[model samples]
Target chain A: MSVEHVVSFDRRSFMKVATGVITGVIAATSPLAALVPSRAWAVDLGALTDAQGAALLAMIRTIAPHDALDSAAYALVVAALDKDAAASAAVKSDLLTGITTLGVGFAQSPESARIAQLKAIESSAFFQGVRVKTLLVLYNNPIAFAHFGYEGEAFSKGGYLFRGFNDLKWLPEVPLADSGPMPV
Target chain B: MAQFDLNDDSVAVIIGSGAGGGTMAHELTRRGIKVVLLEAGGRLTPADFSQDPGAAFGQLTWLDPRTQSGTWDAAKTSPNMPAWHCKTLGGTTVHWTAATPRLQRYEMEARSTYGDVPGTSLVDWPIDHSELKRWYVLAEKRMGVTRRHGMPGMPACNNFKVMYAGARKIGYKRVHTNYLAINTKARDGRGGCIQQGFCSQGCKTAAKWSTLYTEIPRAEATGHLDLRTRSFATRIEHDVAGRANAVIYRDSQGNEQRQKARLVCVAGNAIETARLLLLSDSARFPKGLANGSDQVGRNYCHHLTSFIWGVFDQPVYAWRGATLAGVVEDENIHNPTRGFVGGYHLELVALDLPTLPLVGMPYGWGRGFTDLIDNYRNLAGMLINGEDMPQANNRITLSSTGKDANGLPVAHIHCDDHPNDIALRNHARQQGTKMYEAIGARQVVTSPGSVATHQMGTARMSKDPSQGVTNPYGRSHEVPNLFMSDGSVLSTPGAANPTLTIVSLALRQAEHITKEMAAGRV
Candidate 1:
């Protein structure tokens, strides 16, 4: 995929960006930028290597992993990391600590090795704290997760009504019974 | 006349600015009192309301739903049951389903109809339902409540026809939709409800009775009321004589500030109200302001709520209209045959949205589920929102060492949910499951434990000072100028939602305070 010949898919195409190219796919000018915080452009995340960014994405992906429908989870995490890189030193340090927790050599490691590292990190108190903080802000923000994965909230969209959208159904019926009051 | 400075200099402070708080501010300020209305939450507008439940869960709700704290942890806390509340300018009314059913006559004195259950503090209200009838009408207008009257499927009158007919077949009367604080047609400059399935998420269209659209603005319009949002009251300031003289608060910027007032109103919800008064300890009143009887945070009650969800063969489009349209009240009064002191109202509450199926539906696996999910449209359900008898053990106390960011002690709450409450819930659950079967539901699922929205009874009102924390007029029995007007003021927990009751009492209390002021009694 040459930069000049970047193929444009419909709104749905953004959901299927490749796994390894997630960072580039979710860069500032990419569709995934919409998922990051509104003030993400202002923060400086400090200097991070490709390995550091990959490790951060792997950790976040485990927390809100992508489903089979190509939810583009990895892309969204990359965008968030890219924006976070521009944040203050404190935020930068927190991001580095999070990346290092999943093991700094994540980019060079195999997928299985990276996954095992993530599993170990999950048991630690520091990772639990980071997981809670990231999820709290992400779940509350619809666009952030919507760019990467499906949320129960998105079922309200028109497309979700019927056509086999898992959550939304058109004119879904629920019957009622007036059994009067209980025999008390 | 008994006047101590009520002019521009006299800080006429009204404690809360929700349904009752905002209404009181409008009423008092309209009569020319410089008022300061304090709300512990942030100020919000209609635009601030989101259709997304996830967003609403964060801003309007007290605790964030996604966090582990959102779920009740029985292992960590004693007597664990997560009590849900709203922490916004509109209070719980902001997220309420807008069912405005008035209490039936028997609800006030359930103790007389059925023998009291031990370990329960069931009592009669000092005032009767008729006393608040006129006030109910007033509250209806203030809230801009509307009804279709005799229209078909109008909920109270018409929609109950099908359910009532079934009930009659089983020897019970019909049910009907009660009055609700929602717009039927555009009234008082707010749009009518679009039936958008987002009332509980905070009505984004200004179609519901949230303080954002009504009394708050009316109070603000008078220029007599100054609302300080995000200002959590740390404690009530006491005078030399141990009367409430001022309110000490922590502002949004976390700065300490004190405002002087002739009379102080504590309208924060039950838990916050008790915590504030108890924290306001002085050398003259060490036990806490107006808490000499140690009844400030005692006698807490939340409804023994339960639900029956049914999966039917056809779609009813349950989420199309109000989450609640009508209710059956036959079992809502006292009935000893059921072995319970009080009764419960079976509300025909419909469900919609993805979260309902995800979070509320019964969890299981396999082939049978596909068929049930295919018929998700045909699932009508009934929920039991029954009144629970108050108990002293169900109290809110302060943790000795735990504190919030502002240095205020954390509210350590515990409740020994009585066996009678459990028994009543069991009976209701059985009845609900049967009703689902009667309605042609293929499968019925019941929630073992109940979630409650109607929290009350911490600071009760009574004619005798020893019997209750506040007098009939909501004034403190011990502190002359201190007043309370939230769920904490209910002497008896009614079967219906508590927001309507709280508003009516606040309206009555305002009248009481103004009358006393006019007669020079303050």
Candidate 2:
């Protein structure tokens, strides 16, 4: 039998449970959250002040713009940062250290100054690992940014989050037909 | 029911659900045997898969921000390189590049052709390539392996037109796309690949043939396979007789549960397989379960892969097709000229990520970014996937300091390429340089050695119980019904992606087990 058949097996049988429990608990519209304070986990962006969070969010936007292309990755990072206090702490420290080392103080820096500082540090090996890693985290998995229009979540709207198999490329032609920074 | 007293009561405990587990579950269940295929990862629905390279690495391969800081985290914790694996339901097959080239004739007989590498267990396969031919065809058919035929590059895909043209101009040996276990046409309900160019993340559409899409669901449909998602197997349980009995696993909630089975199959990836075996020690088999010979976690090998990139003068969207499309098999066989016993497959690959060009390139970001962009098209590159000779020193050992939440010893790989590995890599580099120059590359750069992503070879197969963990059928000689079906059973890390071979071996093992079960042997 296929997935179609299996999904249909207990489909309607769980609808009441889905609405009664799953929806009442984790659903976005759950009014129950207000009643159950114990259910609400604390979310803190540690080491990063609210101001720092805003500043980094803005900076990431410039570095990786979300014009026609997807910027959900950026929002996911912010969202993740918003939820996990400890994770945001490491990110906050890394970014602050990177920014300060590049001579751009957080509170005093202009938008242009911040961009310039980020760009300068982008070239350095000291910031290379952290910066690249941060981008990878933010862009690839925007779980934190699920609230925002994180495209990744939308991409997984159908349920294929970790679905298909990877096809191995045993043979490939060299000096490829085209090579350029693909459109973002 | 026959009134014969059954010694073994294993309903079915199949490990892994990639090529092997999937195929086995289908066969065994079809033959009326109840199966319990255990995968130590979450199950993914079709909609959960994506075609975005960025998302692929994020969701498919094992890199999540929640646990990205740890040493075992593939996201940030490569020993020294940018390699990783998937921890999701489809296993690493979710992130595999579905290349399915069969083992060459000599790959099965390397020890006979050349003397064994001193510290390495460079032995030939117990079963020859010919033995796997039918299974390879079955795997290819099941996975929807396809060919582009005459459309340029390797016949494997359409994306290699330009690279194929270039390789031909340079007189490099052009290889046809051998076989891929992804759907080119809808087979077993999976649609043909949409070519979203992001097979790595997981196929969002039911276009790609991951086990989650094909075998897992198929097994689930049979009512014979009991899949428990989020159930992480910590160790194997044995009867007082010291034979295989059950598996001890923990739930996502960190609570332990013991599931009994007469027989067990450890189908976790190579590292996890070896780690599980070593951790499942008993007084009777104190070295580890099925490790009486102490070869349970020995002879680990991964292909010695290295990358070479050249700046091209055109705007080829390397990310438009699957990340790879063409291959130069000029040196897939051992030759006296190359002075290496193993062969390497070269393929044109695009970094496929904007940040990949930025971060993957060896140079600094400024120069590196500009250089890569300036000749993105000209930057057609090839990676030499050199096969590593199995070395005992290059094995997976339990870390003295690290343990997972479940208290199982995490896998600590003591992997360092051998001198011959270095020599083989250098030879591939030289060959890549020559190929690049011949292909009219204005400026070609050969990269230093990189960590191989295709991890394999722990708990390898051999004819003798003294020399190998599993016999030729992937069943442990120490335990009558215990089995291994992942890359860990590979005798040698053949010069190809191991996903297909692992599946084929699993299929073969399933056949063997079914026949044995009929005779009441298992």
Candidate 3:
């Protein structure tokens, strides 16, 4: 379930119930909704605080290990989580709780233990959600796409006609045995 | 179209304007019939579609909170999103990979051919392949399906190339860039596919045959179709004589409006169609409308699917022309020697880096998960499209307590993998692994499988009313004016893709309805 779900399910009863049927309601969009990122357009969002952001970023790097990725790419994921937490205080609390518990002193832990710490929490809802979002946000970044040898320039740049559309070097040839027209 | 008469009962109200309803709108309106096409999502142009897979998923997906049960991985992997269908105006026509393979003859008569496997609800279609052949021709020609009637096939992409090489190595023939509805050389006024690679996530160009641009637009030009986007159908009301006469739906503004109908066509795909039937419970029809047979929400079939990715030593650049370009049809037949009654097709499929982790392995996280995404360009994929046996227990039922954004009870999709389905999937996955391994793939990853594509056979067609909901003509057995225009009318989930067959059935139904109306059959 999503963070909004966590908020609604947990907080539905706390709101003043309509005593004797007369009713009213109020609501607004979350804070940190601003922070529109680049053309790939992962929303630029703010975590509640810096340490929260740091803890989340540390968690993200562990999910997708990349020496090639800039520090900004990790920030892309942190921005999303921060926004997610901003929307739901419960998700925020969950993030902090997970970081503190899953981290096992992440700052001081050896590299192997850090990896092991992340692996322990991989199945948890927070880790899974963060991991899913990280994969989405990071790959959408054009810089990340470039590093991964994926160009979004297929049809836009001359339709892959002159480019390597038919190029498959490693595999064997599949000859056109039935060169005649396909049957209707 | 302007606000249609709320009281006018002449208009044929279609409850979903994607493949079936959109095509019906075009076909019926041209033949001088008024249609009120109700789509449960907004009408979006290509400008609204995002190229990013994640964004596109949010922009296009239904994302409704439907409870899932039984042992299908879809319940565990994508719990909220049971079926991967778009709620938008074009329906899943927007989300299709456009593989338009005709159903093989043996597939239509599964009961006679495959025989009865234990723990399955296998049955024959009311109509045979020969009965559907002429209609299939009309559908193929109209959609400009490649490799048919001299319309050329889509150019081979890197993924298709690798798939072909693998097929050749495995001593299998009949490998080709598919007879997809996507264009090679611009026909039907739509542009040829330049293939920006997000075929599963709405087509960027007007190249793919989504009704948003193709049939719906043409229907709009005839001035007989009132395409109401985001109008969710709640119930099918009928006359005391048991003829469907109206559709009660919540309009975009959340006001419930009952559109009086001369004929009510339920084409909201299988899940919604079945759910709507169950929700429309009445005093006369306690079970549901046109559900006297108790088969309105039974015999659900999602193609037994598996995604296998091959990580090669060199760059395959699988993300090229189309999302899916090639098919190995040699295995799309029943060879009982393979330990499975039915067979499956192995098609070349490619997922972007973002999609690979979430769907390719939704629950995994480790060195291996990172490695899969790290070598995205070097990966080639094969998706097994197997013929799933329809189980009476696997169905779309209205939840006892759970409700939707609207106060109506949500549709809970319950599916347990039949043993036949498991056998077919396992066999196909092994074959895919071997195919990849033969082509010098470093490692092969078999996904625990993912969300469904073709959802079919909830309200199936059969010779006996006790067995199925619709007859050979897709008309309801109980209600004369009600028709099932989507995959819900399908008796079986054939090995190949189901869209072409769905389109063919719609065309044939249109002709039958037209002729019956002329003769005053009702």
Candidate 4:
């Protein structure tokens, strides 16, 4: 369940990191960063600074808090936002301004204080955009899918026909004849 | 494989290729008539369909920008998307649940059965039930529908088992896996369903009947159909004699092309069908083609729909079977004692884990929301497919400002739920809660209605030309050679899903067109 054990970073992605400074920010100071493995897979950030990325991750985790989930799942949202922000100047400015509005040390603040700050600006476009993107990316990730016991894509495994499609043992068995007459 | 000349005036031009248009193309081509079928979207085979819900939605959905103005929940939640229908070659049939319930006699005669319902434009179908019943038999046979014509019903899955037991526990008798146009055993040259559970994602196994793999291909095999994919029809032009003679469309390369026709049949579902007709306005027919009565885009109806979920203590594995394979049909019968003019069916429904939070549940975040996702394996779901009253004001009109990629005015949909629709939904929700509670449900949650998938009654059929856009056979009252072959011709939004009726009407329309062509009338 640790973030270090879940995320695997290849050499190409490690080299793609904009600077060693951002990697140091994630690995050294961030509370969640302390759990990073020795080969720490610092995510590539094109439009967001290391502090902005950390705040965004904290904000996402606060929005969709699952105590059982790893920080790697929340980091995926920041990665996606950074990618969007890199593609659009409007998105970069929005994220920068939105993070600035959250005030400094937002990611370092206690959970209750962070929650109160988020509540005050819950109606803002920035919060709504980040929330929708987090929901889309986080729950659809393999980490969330595995944690929730969701068997994704049955067709590749020959579907659920023989794999307990009708194998509910808790309920009384429904008779096949209960389907009634065939149209003649 | 057939390629008709663009100037060929001997071919019938059919617009959209879902159940209605696809079936029409097959029937006409088989009868030795040449056809030029125009579909706005590109074609995709079962092999191209994705198991991922998000990817499949982008691939198959009609993502064209549409405007919405209404008091319905969709107007607020999905302001840009008022209706949900496919734009692929098979149209919405590619995304349909394949439920094939026949319309009851009373549902067709809404005027006689629900007398004097104020603020509604209720009208009896010009074609009687007995007449349409004949074609329904043919449509069912053609589609190899399970639970009909000696075909056995699909095996009960965990979702269906939960629904059947709960429905029976609540004193309902006529509950079973629904009559679906999917195979239980291999028939009609298609494989049996392996219960893959993504029935809406274009039916990867081809076990579910879709025109993409069935009628359209069959029409191509006959060598009498010129199937044009990615051809967006802009307008229908007519001759001086007031007969539809050509269709102007944008081709795949964004080039404008006009294909001449002997006649035209429009089957672009309800919204697009109405919009296309309105877009065809000419000096000769000022308001729009075949719109002499100004009834072309009036009386839009999408059945009152909502999802009701029951949370159980144990796993139901609702997403293991066909997406919608169970039904409770007893409530589908009309009885004034139920505090509604019409009735509704409670059909089993299940959304995948990724989709459940987005649409199945009320919008929320944090622990309260994550708790529901944690119980995703224990949720049993049902959908209310109830009759929604048709208001004359609930209609499709051309947006004055918004234009599509092709520079045509986008359709603006306006709908405000009638009181009867609200009542039917409330009653259905209560009954659904009781059924689940009878079988030991810990919690019941009801969701707001999603976008209209069962679109109908925009361009309706009527005995009086002033009351409707088409005649009993779906032929336009103003133009002799123009016909509407889709759900747009439905006189009322019956409790049943509109696909079966849409197919039946297409079958009947094809027969009528063949006869009319032989007699030299059209």
lDDT of 3 by residue, A1-184 (tens): 1112111223435654311111111112312122212212221234345455556666777777876655455666676667677688898788767767764457455657777887777678877788878867777765566567777645457555457766776655445442112212
Query: For residue B195, what is the lDDT in candidate 3?
Result: 59
* DockQ-derived CAPRI band for the predicted complex in model 3: acceptable
Each candidate's interface RMSD: 11.4, 11.4, 3.7, 3.0
Candidate 1 yields a Cα-based lDDT of 0.62
Model 1 Cα lDDT, one tens digit per residue, B152-261: 23322121332343344455564655457776566678865555556677776776787766877777787777888887778787777776778878777888878788
Using lDDT, rank the candidates from best to worst: 4, 3, 1, 2
lDDT of 3 by residue, B132-237 (tens): 9989999998988877898777667778777877777888888888778887776778777775677877887778888889898988988888889889999999
lDDT per residue for candidate 4 within B140-191, as digits (tens), equals 9999988899888878888888888889898999888899999888888998
Decide which is better by lDDT, 1 or 4.
4
Report the candidate with higher TM-score, 1 versus 3: 3
Model 4 chain B: lowest-lDDT 10 consecutive positions: B361-370
Off by over 4 Å in 1: A1-184, B1-9, B64-81, B146-172, B350-378
Model 4: CA > 4 A from native: A1-14, A19-42, A110-115, A180-184
Task: Place model 2 in a CAPRI quality band.
Answer: incorrect
- Specify the highest-DockQ model's number: 4
- Which pairs, if any, clash in model 4? none
List model 1 lDDT by residue over A13-92, tens digit each: 44443322332233555554554432122211224654565565555555544332122333333445545544567766
**Which candidate would rank higher by TM-score, 1 or 4?**
4
Pick the winner on DockQ between candidates 3 and 4: 4
Looking at candidate 1, what is the lDDT of residue B268? 74
Estimate, for each residue in A77-111, the C-alpha lDDT of model 2 and write its tens digit. Answer: 44444444345667555556654564535435665
